[model samples]
Target chain A: MNCRVCKKKAVTAIPRHNTAFCADCFDRYLMDQVRKTIKEFRMFEPDDRILLAVSGGKDSLALWDILTRLELDVLGYHLDLGISEYSRESTEKTRIFAEKRGYRLIVEEIESEAGATLPVIAESTKRPPCSACGLSKRHLFNRAARQYDRQVLATGHNLDDEASRLLGNILHWQDGYLEKQLPALPAEGGLIRKVKPLNRLTEKEMATYAYLNGIDYVIRECPMSADAKQIFYKKILNDIEKESPGTKQFFYFGFLDRSQKMFPYSPEASPPSEKCRMCHQPCYTDICSFCRLRMKLSPFPDPEQFNGTHPDVISLHTED
Target chain B: MPESKEQNPDETESVQENEPRRRAPTPIKVFNAQTGDHLEVPFQKRVSSLLLELGIDSETVLVIQKDSLLLPGDSIDPRFEVEIRPVISGGSGR
Candidate 1:
């Protein structure tokens, strides 16, 4: 059968869609989008070491495959969130995949590094575990990259993720967040430059790429992420995509194509403050948020007691 | 961290007037604040707490004040009204 999109000789039959793409064309289409996004945004320099945040999921696995195929100097960084059996399997799969491809992989277990598991953290904080997990992942990724002297950290975030986040930012009119959501964030004094090469590809495209490439990855969702807010936005975007086949692409690429003319870059904008006392990463406060939260989760004073009316609120400080 | 009383007398006087003497500091109201449960802490509290609250390093949230952005190490006058805006994801997608 001929492929519907590329009109090439079909490889395997796509179960539900009843259409198929030739292996070469399918890989090319996905990789081309990534390469275009990289070039369009100048995501990386020729000599920079890129730490690819791989989650042992299709999106990230596909991203690593493409980066390697493109001959980009890249390594894989996976955060082990310690989600019961699921996290262990994902970690092992990610490790094996990286090792087979001769790629360097850095796996950091949160339980070991922070001495707290996700469930424990969630129970103590009353906040969803995903938010804390994301924060820790980001914090550790940047710190690891800096330690390795890698100048760029690449993530598997694709077009769907980008569009969902865009919608969230738009709903709240979060200018600060919107400003930093560009494809390529330049390297500041303390931060390693971050890029999302898969920003142009859709979730479907990534899944297809992963399957076609025969990359081993975990298909299960994080048990803790079942009720995440981002999941709501993703579902909304997915519904929109079902109604409009290329809506996600149109939204994200449209922004990328017109961002320079439509938005004036803020000159006074500085990289986030890196003065976190605990982590010594860039932060606006003396102690980093991760450390503070960890401390809060530990045997510390109650946060509710600190709440008071404005004017008196300043006097409320956590007694160390 | 220096106590308010330890600062220079001239600086201390200026802060003393603005300092919250009887109650917790009121959140500097922004027009149409972001939705969700709005817990408005003082700019410093928001910054300090959010760093831990969000489990993010301090550099993730950018704080702009007094025509200059404060670094993590930079000393900020608690008296100055600080704006708490999250540095979020960006692009042109609607």
Candidate 2:
């Protein structure tokens, strides 16, 4: 079949979409989307120190490559979730990839630093593994960003992830969560500004970019992410997209376009202003959820004694 | 004087006078604890009074009834339990 965009001979078939684009066109399309998102959102300043949250996954590796190619001052931050061999391989790949590209890398192992692993937290909290993993990853990323004095924290959350989260929030009518889910949400009081330059890019395009650009990434899934709600949402969205081409894009971009005015900016409602009590990081409470949970699981002094204090006052209720 | 009053009162009337009136128990409503804001109007108080007791700014507070979502211009009712969840910022507020 002839390439759809460039009229060149197609090398491979895109079975799902049935439309093939030449390698050059595909790369241009992905880069254009990234550039458009950055321009539209004013995501970063020219000299900003962007810390890419790399998970050795396709989405993040592609993001790192694209940002580096764009000549943005970017580094990589990888949090090892300590998932047996899976985490070890992911971190190794991340380190190797960063070293190959001559990019500075910061790696934090939750097990070593927090003295607790995801399995331990999941068992103790009786919650899904992804919940604890996400909490820990977020905490570690934010803390590391501050320590490194990075201006922005970029995640590899693609169109699929954003759409699923949007759908979930809409299903529950969570205004607070919806407010937090915007592409270019205000940095708020204490939070370092975060930007998703790939918010406009799709999963397929990201994978294609990574594949075509020869970016080394781990293809395995997170062991603990097997039963994640996002996986379900992604399947549902993919099914809908199969029925109607560009449906996901329409839903996501349409929401951002039409609902722009509905969400009025509340300057007073900044995120960073909420300081973490214990670590004094930018958090909603005195102590962050990670620190609070860690302290709860730790064999430190009286847990109740720390309750209602600046950092520990956030969650007094123990799961058990 | 006490002896005359006792002589004038009927036994049934005295028994009725000695009985105490019973009142209904007040309902307690808990708000969304995630935000740590709770609004409770004890069956006998105004919302402003409750806010004063909670040490919250009455003007900035969104007084919501128990089990109902907060909306604009909704009057605070004593019959409904109120829960107030504070909206927390995402990060440090500069």
lDDT for each of the candidates?
0.66, 0.67
Residues A103-128 of candidate 1: C-alpha lDDT, one tens digit per residue: 88998888765557877877777756
Candidate 2 docking DockQ: 0.01
In order of listing, the candidates' clash counts read 24, 33
Q: Where does candidate 1 stray beyond 4 Å?
A: A4-20, A258-263, A267-269, A299-320, B1-94
Candidate that scores best on TM-score: 2
Listing candidates in order, what is each one's chain A TM-score? 0.85, 0.88
- Ten residues in sequence with the least summed lDDT for candidate 2 chain A: A311-320
Chain B TM-scores, listed for every candidate in order, come to: 0.38, 0.42
Candidate 1 structure quality by residue, lDDT tens digits, B1-94: 8665566889879988987779665554321111213343444444445344444333223344564334333444555555433322221110
In TM-score terms, candidate 2 sits at: 0.70
Q: Write the per-residue lDDT of candidate 2 for residues A208-236, one digit (tens) a residue.
A: 56656777666555657766777677777
